[model samples]
Target: MIRDILYTLDSPYRAPLEITGFRFGKGEKTVAIVGAIRGNEVQQLYICSQLISKLRALEAKGAITSDNEILVVPSACPYSMNIGKRFWAVDNTDINRMFPGYDRGETTQRIADGLFQHVRGYSYGIQFASFYMPGDFIPHVRMMETGFQSTSLANLFGLPYVLVRHPRPYDTTTLNYNWQMNQTNAFSVYTNQTDRIDEVSAKQAVDAVLRFLSRIGVVRYHCHNGFLASVIDEDQLYSITAPDGGIYRGICHPGDEVTRGDLLGEILDPYTGDVRAPVVSPTEGIVFFGYAQPLVMEHAILYRIIRRLHG
Candidate 1:
């Protein structure tokens, strides 16, 4: 089920890089699911591979019922994947940050341009990603204002949190924005932490996607109830900073729940044998995320709190 497409690039390097996709079912609606724009996010690529294997089996047996198209790009950044780095080999640049792409530019731009061209015809575009930087994430999907289809897909994906965010000013060169400009339905699903495979985030992503496929009628399946995590608005998210110094963190993980005034962590001055100050939770809600490294500094974010907004 692996179909390799070589996009011709203007380079002395003759053979085009092999981009692989798993094609399944037959329909007017095509969904291009891509992963590993950042080489470090091998987990996303792995998830895509799993999805393709299942879908391909269904296709072979005639059990695949979706009239819609599902094209899976398991790894977009091959160079990065090879080097175990996050950027392209020619010049170390972030592929995700570079959107529409330039034909006359470097490797990152060329790849973006190539990717944009290949996915332009799709009805829905999904980009799977994890933090190219390592950290725990509250699983979420980000949809662009221009992506009506993406918004719908985000809901269908049924992730715990579906957030509609404008592509940051710096995100113009990303695949998501390029899909938007081409009138292709596009959205991005992401988890926190980079360079390491997080099984929890991967499963959460797959779960959301399966729910989405079912909701769109692209596939038939029974989704377990209570599948989504609590989706919160960005405005409701607040970060608690370390006021003092020392390795400070309380008994809290990324997804733990906390009440207001709960002791989240503390900064200590071991040299002076002093416990500088304790960082406390500001609201009663879930601990959406926190820093992982131990060496602390003043103004370092210890935790991000998502307060329940009163309606």
Candidate 2:
């Protein structure tokens, strides 16, 4: 099927937001995948568009078919996307934070309302993007404690790691939280940092989704080798912070693997160029993330060591 442009929200003051997607096959297992709810996440939009294109090609060749509908909204916030910002033009509110939105609310709220309304009928939902957190990413799925279905889907996504997050009561209005709360199942998969997007991370994400859809019978392509069956809890994370305030330098880049007590970085006295103290790894693990900037504060996170034993 040729992909369709469902609706375009025009802005006389700026460029319009285009909601584009494709639907294929027919059955009870409808799925909705959205990306770039935050405007600045162009990488996610591009990657989701790529996925959409590939799925369309496969569907046309009869190489792919879904038991249920698959709806993909590749770029959700066009105005923010056009401006390369993360918030709506009207109030600068985060659309993701204002989910299950009211129809008569602000512009972004209206957009959220529309998305929530559209996705509610689906059996499963996924929101993909790069996050605002610092440093390189280790692919992970974030879920609310909705039920076993959320857990199963998170495992099925096959990311290198999984984060089983609890939806803080305050976060109950978020897309995933609200959907899960209302008996609809949804999960979020993402890389770290909205500002930096890498090809490796993007490819990993697409691979994860390919496997997920395959398992769900959304497509026929399957690669069992890519799945990472373990789920990582918040406790598994260990942070290595700077001991003193100084000009900081990291010994390893994000995504590098290391053993316990490995040298992570160092702090230097800015004026004298003297070594302040070395920041050592807290545990044997991969440097999943860290601060990229050269400056530091006492207790600033110089590196995030996700214990190797967990992997």
Candidate 3:
């Protein structure tokens, strides 16, 4: 196992932000796995750490294929993580949104640029990503509809679901989208937690990546057969929003199957202790995301259901 610094940013008031990567085997850059671009993504970083340990063991056993190199970057924004901030500490900007970045641009952009310079040409790229909102959900592999995405390729991860998201204008600047634009097949892997750690889903994520590496001939590790994976479009999810800001109680959790008109959750008036709104399922399907936080705001997304496909 070889450890190297992929990028660095000096700080006068704090330790230099160092993006470090671990390399296993030698030759072609077959795959690159990144984690924790945002500070709050503790689960993502933990998953990558577990993966690195697994890879180190595999490397010791000569399990990695010859002429195949894999890079694992555990975290990209350590400064924010140190301070428990979600974005760049200085500017409050997202590194992910800068993408194929500019060296002469802002701090986050330069960090993005420096990182991208080192990771771009790999055959496959995997990012352990977190959701924009805080919630617990079924683990899935997500891909951008960048005209270069392949559900078949994504299924190799063997996760339960594959989400193909249509890119909005802002998505053009994201790492996953830009990676595809540069002819590299990239995927974002989401586990069940973010700020907190869940052992089951973390192991599941590590196993999924190992499965993919084995399938792609990069490693000799044998793993359990994961799901065949159901593909869903991002726009097709049935979203349930909170009717009013209040204390929330979700009866249904992620991966739970619900029937149409089922009372999935309820919102209570914090002051009156009365049920103010009952969130219901409109269609029969699995809950992809379930509200986990105790509080909710009016019109905030509470649930996103994946409707079952017909024969």
The lDDT-based order of candidates, best leading, equals: 3, 2, 1
TM-scores, one per candidate: 0.85, 0.86, 0.98
Judge candidate 1 at residue 217 and give its lDDT: 66
User: Can you list the residue pairs that collide in candidate 2?
Assistant: 260-284, 285-308
lDDT of 1 by residue, 84-117 (tens): 7777767778877766777688777777777766
- The RMSD (Cα, Å) of candidate 2 is 2.9
Candidate 3 residue-wise lDDT at 30: 89
Compare the candidates by lDDT and give the number of the best one.
3
| Per-candidate local distance difference test | 0.71, 0.74, 0.93
Best by TM-score: 3
Residue-level lDDT of model 3, residues 41-85, one tens digit each, is 999999999999999999999999999999999999999999999
Candidate 1, residue 99: Cα displacement in angstroms equals: 1.5
For residues 89-156, what per-residue lDDT tens digits would candidate 2 score against the true structure? 67889888888888898777777887777777787888885544445556678776656345766788
Report how far off residue 69 is in candidate 3 (Å).
0.6
lDDT of 2 at 286: 79
Local lDDT at 209 for model 2: 78
Model 1 accuracy (lDDT, Cα) = 0.71
